[model samples]
Target: MAVPVPRQRDTPATESAQATPPAVAHATAPQASLTLLVIEDDPAGGLTVPEILDADRHRIRLRTARNLTEAARLLTQDVHCILLDLSLAGTPGGSGPGAGPGTAGAGTAVADQLAILREVLRIAPRHAVLVLTAEADAERAAEAVRVGAQDFLFRDELDGRLLSRAIRYAVERKRADIAQYKLAESKLRAQENARLERGLLPNPLLEGSDLRFAARYRPGRSRALLGGDFYDTVRTPDGTVHAMIGDVCGHGPDEAALGVELRIAWRALTLAGLCGDDLLSTLQEVLEVERPCEEIFATLCTVDISPDGRRAGLCLAGHPAPLISRPGRRAQLLPYENSGPALGLLPKARWPRRQVELGGAWSLMLYTDGLIEGRIGEGRERLGQDGMVEMINRHLDRGLSGEGLLEASVTEARRLNGGELTDDVAVVLLSRTDG
Candidate 1:
């Protein structure tokens, strides 16, 4: 059922006027529709911006602001871009101290406007901001870009198509800048962390000891080089070699720094012939002075072997007891009784010195809590004392001794956690066997 539609006829004069002009056939373009905020302070006559069309010929939806206060109010999440008029009367707010050089006195006003742009960048890190400057002040427009604006547009050349393209480009450029900036920041942080870790980790000074030294370290903080875990070993003049391992309660850089300080103080005191209670007491004093806050504390375990290398003295301060294994017997934990609280907890805390008989052929293992605390399987149970003992026995049966033992333990712990342990794990193995 088709029906015919009638067409209206026009007079000769109307037809002639409706014909296109010679220049009307010039290359036309499309425009894109975008939501934009125009910050202008002409109260008498509101913003009279020419229709800004994008490549698709869709006119931009414009919101007008007479002042900074109104502009702030109109800056909703939906506002994709801001077009700020430089001739706007009110000064911007919240300028920080690091305003660029040559911006002093009334230049402070310009600094404040730049600060506003910076704040906007912070708030809408992905949004685009284009400054509207007069033709003569085009240089200032460039400065605005340096101050974090996405782009600057001249009022004389301001048209719908140009404004739309500028907005699109600014948004994309701002996004790229943000991503690149974050990547660089991450790289710098990683470099700093690596340097700090080199200072925190333990270095074995067992140059002449017949015993094999092996150790491994892992920080719990994701992608961190080191945590609050620290260890050190040094052989003194009296042929009495001292070894220590400890852990602070946190995984921050401050905690790592404190751990390093404590380890250095321990080495200094031990080398100065301070042992047992005197050495530990001095270290506690150091912790009290150097710790960032009173709440910070550190746990430690230290071992000192005599010149003959047959016997050793062990001291513990709120730390896990070290494991010992002899040639013909299963490994066992030394009796850890009457151990004092961690350092910086109590001024008069006492760490009991216990005697452990290490035969000519024996190995002692010291480690932080991160090793045994990992989950063994999908269960809620942890690979605690029994698990560690069995694991060590199996390794000993396989003739895995010295550094090999420490490597096995660390690798096993990571396997149990299904990946790297989520805490800082530092393990030191001292094996003394008749050569």
Candidate 2:
């Protein structure tokens, strides 16, 4: 009687489940038994070997295929390993003339003999394979091993105990090889991602400026370094410091790329002596042309501090007003009354530059809406402008400033949201210390 080998067949979903799950879902239980498919064509009958036995004495179930066609039919996910008779003769997977196939006009040489082995390997990439051959073909057997076979067994050495052990060992060794490949692949992928991250994020151009800058950015997507939110600070050759933060509409790679484009455009325009409404109009043109879709839009906030550092020009393109904190004064939002429609939402719109006094020493924070849109709890209440202002005041009471201030604010926001904030958050802080 053929032993029962309980195994799960491969489905698209099953293949995906075999991969690591992102969230909780069905778990695959360990397979109960292993099945081996033996390929051979003996004139009288199938493999003459006796019934194979596993280590637990449970009989190793066997399925015999006389030719390549039958072998293809028997190859299934449930079959854990294969025992192929290399000496057997037939076409590759029951196709073409079996005499010679590898080269255009070569005879049935060693290459053709091993062509069947190659076909078997191609058809069953994830399964383990072992070869059965005569002792006179020991050279061919070793060559087969080099080609991809797990091991080769001589006809005289074929026994129930040796096969069972070989089956188990071959299965384990195949799994180890796959695991090592995946590890190497993942490491290489991570290194590439690190390179991408460095390229995407900008380096501040604050040379010869006394403005201390700090920033905090987090992508809502797992394992992502850049997001749809972007920001940068640079000091103009005229000694005026300029900083801006903006957010593209979506939370995807395309959106992230768009954000980077906008940041670069802003930097180039600022360096080329564009500011306020003119720079924004040019950016709007860039946005209208570069956005992935007509419906896409971006919110932006830009500030240009005068050479003396006591005042700044603020422009809001449907973005939140920056927050300003000075000694003896609680942190508060900058004026947003003159804010215009977000870019791409209006044609030929104008962003008015509002002049504001910054005092002698203060910290100015510009951020994307993500920082304020997080849920306050499990409830529908969001940490809107009012709530964010209040939170910043509390942090100010704790005497936090610069990097520490930004980190604490983000942590508190996430804590209040009950988990990670489900949007890309980007916050930039620029501080000036004047005697």
Which candidate has the highest lDDT of all? 2
Question: Across residues 274-345, which tens digit of lDDT does each residue of candidate 2 receive?
Answer: 999999999999999999899999999999999889999999999989999998988889888968889999
How displaced is residue 417 in candidate 2, in Å?
A: 1.9
Error of 2 at 406 (Å): 2.3
Q: After superposition, how far is residue 399 of candidate 2 from its true place, in Å?
A: 3.2
Query: Count of backbone clashes for each model?
Result: 10, 0
In order, the Cα lDDT scores of the candidates are: 0.76, 0.83
lDDT tens per residue, model 1, 231-294:
9999988788899999998989899888888888998898888999888899999998988999
Candidate 2 Cα deviation (angstroms), residue 408: 2.5
State the TM-score for model 2: 0.84
Global CA lDDT computed for model 2: 0.83
Per-residue lDDT value at 343 in model 1: 87
